[model samples]
Target: MLHPEIQAKARAELEGVIGLDDNGHIPRLPDFEDRPKTPYLEYILLETTRWAPLSPLGVPHASTNADEYKGYYIPAGATVFANAYAMSRDERYYSSPEEFNPDRYIPVSEGGRGEPHPEGPFGFGRRVCPGQHLAMAGVWICIATLLATMELKCPVDEEGKELRPTVGFSDGLSGVPDAFGCRMVVREEAMELLGL
Candidate 1:
């Protein structure tokens, strides 16, 4: 993984929630039942969304009435785009806007210094993505399960040098990561947990 510390922290959290059984293996996979107690995992998911939001420019909305913002006048019915990307990395809200730090979402009581706020990668207002909740839930479950059962690392070339992926996204309405290479190895305990 690019950030081993964060991955280790998440795995540690998983261990605390669904610890080993008599055979010294993780007894079960993470589920909705464990979601409430896995705050750190939640932070990781949130950070993933913020770091590379799928939709940089949210769905366009038309102004119902004429309005003025920062000395700019907008006629009625003018289409307005919410730059979700800018908001996600706004220096005013995030301390290190460019860094991918999940701890930013962790509460102060939990030893993290992030300020609590309602902003998310999802679009805002009444027009916000209707499936945001469902999408987040799905992403959370997938990420948690994967991190619990495998190790992700940058791939290596035939010469044995590690391939460091360039952190860039394709230009489009949606900001998708450019082609990259990585390696995923199943954890030894994963098979046992899977009853394989």
Candidate 2:
């Protein structure tokens, strides 16, 4: 069940925009255009993707033939793995790289690169994720609705260690956070007209 406290925060944000709480029965479901106004949710979506990247190591690529990349000779049939996780955490690309803060994606200007480091590690050139648009849309919608009407909070146990998420993962294809518990709350009024 969603936690009430988190819900309150989301609801507050919603009310600030939507002005009513009809049990989340808003005028319409969220969409892409709502992104600018619902910027926080966008950050949440990107952060979620960064936090638990779909693939720790992105799709593997093989060198088709002998070629010189930079100064090194890469022979044919060489296997390569792109570390999305590492890129996301690179200090050159991110500030406070180890923290789980999601505000990195929020744009600093009208047409500028936003926070959360815009340099994507989704694979290079043609090998990039084929479903990038679909994936982003799914993530955006899910996050939008959540931020629109729900809150997420970390849960603590009796010892109060703040239960760190598992560092290692089983999937050789990707790196993912280990199992951890957190509280999710539904906000009473976290939606708005948006005028989109």
Candidate 3:
């Protein structure tokens, strides 16, 4: 379950841009048309995906049969993987990859002028993520609603230092970040808007 604070925050943001049809009644949920009005929401999606990739190493690409290309011999059943983590962190692609800077996605132009390569996270070719649009839209809505109302705070230890959360991962066919913790705070007005 989401922290109450987080839920409240999302409600607040949703109420604002969702707007009223002049009848004092809540309108339908946000849509793409409302995207221009809520840029930060989209940034949240990009940041989340970048911070925790769907696949640390993208789906493996394999050769169907033995062949030679670029003077390299290919054997059938050869295991391959595209490094999603490296691609995301490439100095050529992102500036200050270590820092969590959502501003990197602020640009609306094609490929995010700031990104080293003009490509979004879904990837390329016939093997690209089939659900890119659906995933992006889902993330966009969730983030937009969340930021609209709540404030996220990092948990701190007794030493008065913010918790340094780490992504625990295992070596295997799939890589996933381990569990971590954080704090959430929701303001009063935000909750009222969300109707929570």
Candidate 4:
């Protein structure tokens, strides 16, 4: 809802892939096999993780041996937290870190910036989230499904102006965005396809 253009682009890809029935209704839901055909979806997911990491401070790790960086010294055992949030917004990589654009992941040959996929969202090294694969798959399908059928956008006020949300996130170990209002109207075509 915060980014309607992104949603529209994703939906367009889905529509091209899924197409419509002879009756001019959606024919089927997106499947795993659509991965290749819907590359934009992957970019969107990647941008989502990079834009707003779920774990701002990734899972803490304990050093088995002493380590030092610069002039700082560490004991044999110390707890360390990777600042995933800061890494996400690093200008060195992302052109406009504040903007929620997914096209950055596309390769230079594909006319995109070819930015590298982000790291540290799941974790670092061997301590990486064990279920990262499952989590990503689940998230991808959920996002694809929502975009396929819904018109997600800001709600209009009495004056018919969009009520752009004041984007905010919850505090703590989690980086869940604060709740915001938006419309999620099921596309008329989708409803007709579903026989609703």
Best by TM-score: 4
What range of 10 consecutive residues in model 2 has the weakest lDDT sum? Answer: 1-10
Q: Give every collision pair in model 1.
A: none
Output the number of the lDDT-best candidate.
Answer: 4
Where is the poorest 10-residue window by lDDT in model 4?
A: 187-196
Deviating ranges (above 4 Å) for candidate 3: 1-32, 66-73, 108-113, 116-123, 156-164, 167-170
Worst 10 residues of 1 by lDDT: 114-123
lDDT of 2 by residue, 1-196 (tens): 2234434444454445544445554554456666566555555556656666778778888989988867988889998777787787778767777665555665778553465543454666876768787888877777666656556766768987555444545677755546767766544343344432
Q: What is the full ranking by lDDT, best candidate first?
A: 4, 1, 3, 2
- The TM-scores, one per candidate, come to 0.92, 0.68, 0.68, 0.93
lDDT of 3 by residue, 66-128 (tens): 888689888998976667777778777678876656567756474464543224356668878
Report lDDT per candidate: 0.83, 0.61, 0.63, 0.86
Report the number of clashing residue pairs per model.
0, 18, 4, 0
Query: How does candidate 1 score on lDDT?
Result: 0.83
Clashing pairs in 3: 9-149, 9-150, 10-145, 13-148
Ranking by TM-score: 4, 1, 2, 3
RMSD after CA superposition, every candidate: 1.7, 5.8, 5.6, 1.5
